[model samples]
Target: MLTPSKVLDLYFLEARCMLIEVAATLDRFDRAVDSDTNGDGGDDRIEKLYESLQVLSSKSETPDRSEQLLKLFSGPA
Candidate 1:
C-alpha cells in the first residue's frame, strides 16, 4: 500500500507532467496564432492562456495554496 507521502509524490509528478503538456499545447496554439492572420478575437484568448501558463511556470519560494485555489476556481486573471 502507498503511504500518504508516496501518494502525494505521485500526485506531484502527475501535476508536473500535466503542466508540461499544457505548456506544449500552448506552444502549438501560439504557433498557430502566429501563422493565422484572421484576427477574429482568438488573439485575446490565446494571450490570456499564455499569461496563465506563465503564472503556472513561475518558481515561487513558497507554495501559495490560496492563490492557486483562487486561480483554479476564478478561471484566468
Candidate 2:
C-alpha cells in the first residue's frame, strides 16, 4: 500500500531523475562543444549549457531530493 508520503516521495524522485538526465545531456553537449572553432561564438552555447546545469544542481538540493538523481540511484545525498 502506498501512503501519501510515499506517493509524494515517488513523484519527487521521478522529477529529480528527469532533471538529472537533462543535466547530464546538457553537460555532455557542452563538453562536446569544446572542440568547436568559431571565434568564441561556439563558446556561447557551452556557457548556456553550463548555466542550465548549475540551476539543475541547485534544484536537486532538498531533503529527500538532495541527490544527483531524484532517488533513482543509490548515490550520495
Candidate 3:
C-alpha cells in the first residue's frame, strides 16, 4: 500500500516527465519544419512535422491527473 506522500511524489514526477516529453516533441517538430524548408531531397519533412504537431497537440490537450498536479505544484506562484 502506498502512502499519500508517495502517491503525491509520483504524480509530480509524472507531470515533470510529461512536460519534458512535450518540450522534446515540440523541438522535434521545429527541427522537421526547418529541414523541410531547407531540404532539397523532397523528403516531405514538412508532412512529418505536421503529423508530429498533431500528436503533440493531442498530448498537450489530453486531460489526466496533471491538472491537479500542476495546481498543487504551483503553490501561490
Tell me the tens digit of each residue's lDDT in model 1 across 1-77: 88989988879889889878987988787787778888543646666566666666688788684486457557555
Superposition TM-score, candidate 1 onto the true structure: 0.50
Best-to-worst ranking by TM-score: 1, 3, 2
Q: Score candidate 3 by lDDT.
A: 0.61
For 1-77, candidate 3 gives per-residue lDDT tens digits of 87989988779789679768867976877776668865544456445545544554565545554454445345486
Candidates 1 and 2: which is better by lDDT?
A: 1
- Model 3 stretches with alpha carbons more than 4 Å out: 1-7, 38-77
lDDT per residue (tens digit) for residues 1-77 in model 2: 88989988879889789878877877766676675676343545455555545555574445443343334333455
Clashing pairs in 1: none
Model 2 residue 46 CA deviation in Å: 9.4
Q: Is candidate 1 or candidate 2 better by TM-score?
A: 1
Query: Considering every candidate listed, which one attains the maximal TM-score?
Result: 1
Stretches > 4 Å off in candidate 2: 1-7, 37-77
* lDDT (Cα atoms) of all candidates against the true structure: 0.71, 0.61, 0.61
Per-model TM-score, in order, reads 0.50, 0.38, 0.40
